[model samples]
Target chain A: MDLNQTIRCIVKLGGAAITCKHELEKINEENLETVSSQLRQAMNLGSCSNKVIGMDWSKRDGVLDISSSLADFDDQRQFTVDFSRFVVVHGAGSFGHFQASKSGVHKGGLSQPLVKAGFVATRISVTTLNLEIVRALAREGIPSIGMSPYACGWSTSERNVASADLSGVTKAIDSGFIPVLHGDAVFDDRLGCTILSGDVIIRHLAEHLRPEYVVFLTDVSGVYDRPPTDPNAVLLREIAVDEDGKWSVVKPTPQSMNMQVEITVAAHDTTGGMVTKISEAALIAKLGIDVYIVNAATIHSLKALRGELRHNIPDDWLGTVIRFSR
Target chain B: MDLNQTIRCIVKLGGAAITCKHELEKINEENLETVSSQLRQAMNLGSCSNKVIGMDWSKRDGVLDISSSLADFDDQRQFTVDFSRFVVVHGAGSFGHFQASKSGVHKGGLSQPLVKAGFVATRISVTTLNLEIVRALAREGIPSIGMSPYACGWSTSERNVASADLSGVTKAIDSGFIPVLHGDAVFDDRLGCTILSGDVIIRHLAEHLRPEYVVFLTDVSGVYDRPPTDPNAVLLREIAVDEDGKWSVVKPTPQSMNMQVEITVAAHDTTGGMVTKISEAALIAKLGIDVYIVNAATIHSLKALRGELRHNIPDDWLGTVIRFSR
Candidate 1:
């Protein structure tokens, strides 16, 4: 898999999308499978540079070296679009948020012995959830390797991510494997340990890797003018980055509902909720990256994320699209 | 939990000790429970300086601020033996070996797509096993936080572990939480990805942390002159590191076996063999650190590793003790 030939993208599955966020540690297998399928489709529809013939990942001896003549024979055939590399990040959702909130781990004091224990409990729960996500992706033949933020991420005294060595993630992608990362408990200099949000991780990765697309797959359709639950709520078509590299919401027409900030569903999340996600997305958009906030629960929304609906979709797609204002 | 006041130790449970390495992915519940019990006993017996009362981790609101005067009053009491810090590392026996060996992951060279897929398979298997260990320890009232090496370990171009950020492990120990590490597949510049043995991890950690003691709990009694299956085979009680920092075997008695090199059971390990473990241990022993290899299957051996038999036992202990030549 040549890194240069890969159409790099980051697809972050919201905790609510793959796991039962309302239920502690319960995996939403159906939703997980759905998301995995869409990701597989995305992989098959992108450009794969190293699509070698006679390469069977399941068979031990099947990966034989192809002769030059055989390579020429393969080159004579037309190839389908397929992704050469991808990075998948998921939210902690029920697994981490429940324990983190209970322990106040998101608040980051971490001096008390009891709080430290809570940090352990939260880490265990979140990693367990990570296992499920990896399994689902594997079942879909994504070859997703689970990566932990705690192991590689270093946080400053203020409990912000100082550095995270994503070289492993880069290597996995270069090797034609999906690297699955999630919200996790990590070391903090001042606080003993703290939670690094998946949103923050995606934003940082998109800025560094400069992926062509960044997708946030959530339970809702997209960002709404008001809480989506409200009868008069209207979904926002787009949230754009200004020429000055500042974030601004598309002004609402009388047809759209009026609301200023993002209204995320009430959950155990301590990482500033949906508003934070939107803010992070906007930051990525300012870098000229196309960011999508879509409802993975519906197949249409997932297809939009995979660009399958790009040909026939209206300007107001199934989800909110964030890009540069011009 | 003051870092300076704590007594730290790293205890590694071999895959053969805690799980049925002979059986694919089958955990030896009986062995796991036994090891957990011994570890719990060891914790309670070690010196603990700050054992607080009225604290419960499961409860959300129980972590109240301790009155300053009350803390002073509580501080006046004599403290008993309890380990203040612990880091547990375990081997990936059945959980990883089968897939790793099949994928040739331990031998490195993951350029092949199939080998890269194998890396993911091995990580999932090892992490799954790690969860079992964490759950068992938690059931025994040990607050064990699962730490994935893939998250932190970085290998040099030569496939040697160049750096593993142990800040989280240190923080976990300092805060009185047990961080459980295991053999894992990590990113390597030379090989793309490679297996990191638990023994090597233990040695690297002991050198950096300089823990008071490091114990390896395995299925066998200790290092033997030959395979323990041989009817006439005998255990070599001790292997000493000379003053010159070189490893040397103690002369066998008339009743003991005379072989020098370590003889490990033939399993699916690709990260070298038993010889690798003994070599790594010898390196740590040369650093003036005490290293113990004992059969976790026997309570007596576990007790010996915990130093419970120190009062009545001879300088040469029941298990294989590796230390600098006296």
Candidate 2:
């Protein structure tokens, strides 16, 4: 529990797990509390180094009112720039896609991050959801900031924000805090703007932080030989990142890209399946750093990999531990 | 001014006309008061029946909260029920489309209306807008009701409503109150659902009432011989509702159905415009009713029509009052 420990792991959480596939209305405080406790434990597990748990916002509330955003953060004097030790790249589902689409308006139209402005009412709801997340995080003593790609000016020449000042995350981490980020749409060089998935975000971070290991905690048990949907699907406990990425990889359907991450853990009940994370892991593992893919239920595995938990035990065999030879 | 003596007109107010479109903000009260005053003067000038101004809502603050709807009717005990004198067919812009597309789920995707379980967020917005409109009408001392085609059903086989059980509207109007309706997608027998417009509500009413003179009002000046933007355009003072429906006909594009109903009376505007009024006029005018097309600004014209302020008699036109036969 020493605060002076050097951090070893820089874990990026997928939106599905953090937002609980958005099933619990808001952040699913029960799950968050549990995840929060695990993250805290992992952070303190090792006297070696303090780990940073980053977030890839699972969803965003599009209907943010200046008053509400201000009121929600006003007394505490919190603003859009107040993310924790983690830097973030969040999504706009919380903003207005609902309203924009309702009006048959897809502003960019099949372009990067596919958004329209007509869904004003839906944005209103998303705004509520976004506030709920903020409130829950705040209550947990976790300071979180909310951002949307449509409202924020983070884009690359090809996309919107290439390296979107993930500085919010880095600063949070540097300040001895847990920086939380989320899956987002970033300006892209290739597609004008592409979804910066939680896994993709880790890929982005790997280029910058060069951390020893990147872990993805999700609801699913782990990666599978085939789609987990099938009754006969078997769990693939472990695999070399490069070996599995090329010969075996699954593409995401039109509805989602999260499921297409190279190699990561997944929840059985969430929208994005293991196939998506597998893709993300493969992409990050290529950077020569190791990745620990595990169910959020057992985040201790993350701490174990960080040399924090000194146990050699592999519980559940329900997770994957990925590493690089470089 | 005696309340009952006020000339009655059903003004279908567009959500855009009254709201700060993207900001989701209400129109300021000072401006609203002026608009309401102009409405009163217009009422005094017109021979039309008691006016019932219906608000076409774009958003609802809450289901139980009807504060915005009751903006103008501060004098009486405002009553709100899901009852209507007019079968208002309202467009569900900023509520349905973007949310549907965002969820990658469509219930009644254009091919029909309310066909799917749909997104929770989209449904909330739709319901909220309905409440706002209904609530506004009630506040104005106008007995009002909210109606959605999903609840009533549509004639999918013919891309229309075979029969809208508009018992609510009938009861309201029969009680000597104005019935209001708007554009809306309804459950259909064929396409599974179809969108019925507010104009059609008037058309159906015409089939029943068959008034001697029907009035049409809207945002723009009356229909013109050429596009209004053209320099040589001439205002179309008289529109012939003929067998072919060549004149007084408006069509809907994917972007907007409002175009067909944009005609209004010129400066010196009269009562406000009802977009589908022209189409309704076409349907009823064919039955021998003379429909007057005027803008809300033409106050003097309304006074002349009401036999209040006399129109100046031109010396050259004194003995030239020859009636043209249709």
Each model's C-alpha lDDT? Answer: 0.69, 0.40
Q: Could you tell me which 10 consecutive residues in candidate 2 chain A have the lowest summed lDDT? A: A110-119
Q: Number of clashing residue pairs in every model? A: 5, 121
Q: Which run of 10 residues does model 1 chain B get worst, by summed lDDT?
A: B53-62
Q: Taking the tens digit of each residue's C-alpha lDDT, what string does model 1 give over A183-278?
A: 987766676567888988898888778887888899888777656776866676667788676665673443354443433322312433666777
Give the chain A TM-score for each candidate: 0.81, 0.61
The count of residue-pair clashes in candidate 1 stands at: 5
Error of 2 at A138 (Å): 3.4
In order, what DockQ does each candidate have? 0.23, 0.01
Model 2 lDDT tens row, B1-326 = 11222223434343333333344323323323333344334433423434333322223332323233335544322322212222233333344434344332333432111122122223334444554444443334333334343333222344444765444344334433343344443434444434454456555655555433444433344454334555654444445555655454321121433232334322212332332444556666676655444432345224322323123323221110101124
Local error of candidate 1 at residue B270 (angstroms): 13
TM-score of each prediction: 0.81, 0.38
- TM-score of model 2 (CA atoms): 0.38
- Top candidate when judged by DockQ against the true structure: 1
Judge the docking of candidate 2 as incorrect, acceptable, medium or high: incorrect
lDDT by residue (B21-57, candidate 1, tens digit) is: 7667778999998888778667766445434322122
Q: Tens-digit lDDT track for model 2 on A75-175?
A: 33221222223332323332333333433332323221112111222233343444344334433333343333222223444432354554434433443
